[model samples]
Target: MDVALVTSLKDGMNLVRYELVACQDSKRGVLILREFAGAAQSLGAGAILVNPWNITEVSNAIGQALDMEPEKREKRHNHNFLHVTTHTAQEWAETFVRYETILSMKLLLLFLGLLSLINQFCGTSLPLLVASSDIILVY
Candidate 1:
């Protein structure tokens, strides 16, 4: 069904919420989300958080969402729109790779230190030298 109001009980990374917010760039829409939903933490500031089990609460939220002033709706939509546009999946993946690469390099350096001592004692050379510039993250 096509509607301006979007509600969800519980979801893991509710992409529908982002889709709704993205589509509502011209027309401000309302979103009522459950507190336990994964997207709530990110969009709760803009969405109306409610308990789905509470029918009265949910009903009241529906009314509030429908009857909300244009200025308020615009403000809420702006918040969510900004988040959705800036925090994209590619951006998140790139950030994860950057962080993990740094952590892995640190651990590798620690291991290499032990190898250095062994090489000195055994009068042997290790070809396991890695330069920071050698690893380039294109993304």
Candidate 2:
């Protein structure tokens, strides 16, 4: 950003002006500032540019103009919180389902251990128990 006090001499008369230029890097090229003689112009009243230099005032004016532009406003709405929250919720739910599946497998192993203890206490070589145990081991 560049702020300058310009003096133009016309017919032996000194015409003083305060000019502000703000620029930024863009994909296409460096985005040059819009000329002040157009629709958007400064409203400073003075015979000459006598105001104290203020970077903050120049920055605020540029910020306000860029924010009010239509393209920037649309881009802000496109990245709104509603879309971001929905994407985050889906990722969290997928993680929860994965942990629940791991817990269920651990519970199943504990139940099998209890059944094996009961078989040993009864002193029984149960045929159905042996076959089912083999099937569980294969899985």
Candidate 3:
């Protein structure tokens, strides 16, 4: 988890530089966790590190992170911030949507938006397609 990374500087748990985070592949995945772990080790100097499995280890990691010198912590955080900003997309959040749900919602929103647009424009009737594939118009 990036709990420590999410904390603010001087918060004693700098999991990431905090300026940015790519996290494209996954926000929650083992590979993502491991990737974060690797980055924390090299960039944060194990200050924001955690095992996630062992409670004791997590606690110890937190204490170790909090006790690090401020200058060293700042330096490590800068590295994380730099890497996140330079190497990754500024905004790359991926979300899952069901195909059927997405299609239905998009169609509904487009239909509503077009309807509203037409209502705001010329005074005329517009054809509306129905579930039966039949065209219907309103006067």
CA lDDT, candidate 2, residue 18: 18
lDDT of 3 at 132: 29
Error of 3 at 33 (Å): 6.8
Q: Which parts of model 2 have CA positions greater than 4 angstroms off?
A: 1-87, 124-139
Number of clashes found in candidate 3: 2
Local distance difference test, per candidate?
0.77, 0.37, 0.46
Top-scoring candidate (lDDT): 1
Q: Rank order by lDDT, top first?
A: 1, 3, 2
Q: Model 1, 83: alpha-carbon shift in Å?
A: 1.4
Backbone clashes for every candidate come to 0, 0, 2
| Residues forming the 10-long window of minimal summed lDDT in candidate 2 | 21-30
Cα lDDT of model 1 by residue, 69-133, tens digit: 88998889899999999899899999999999999999899779866755665654534433455
TM-score of structure candidate 1: 0.74
Ranking by TM-score: 1, 3, 2
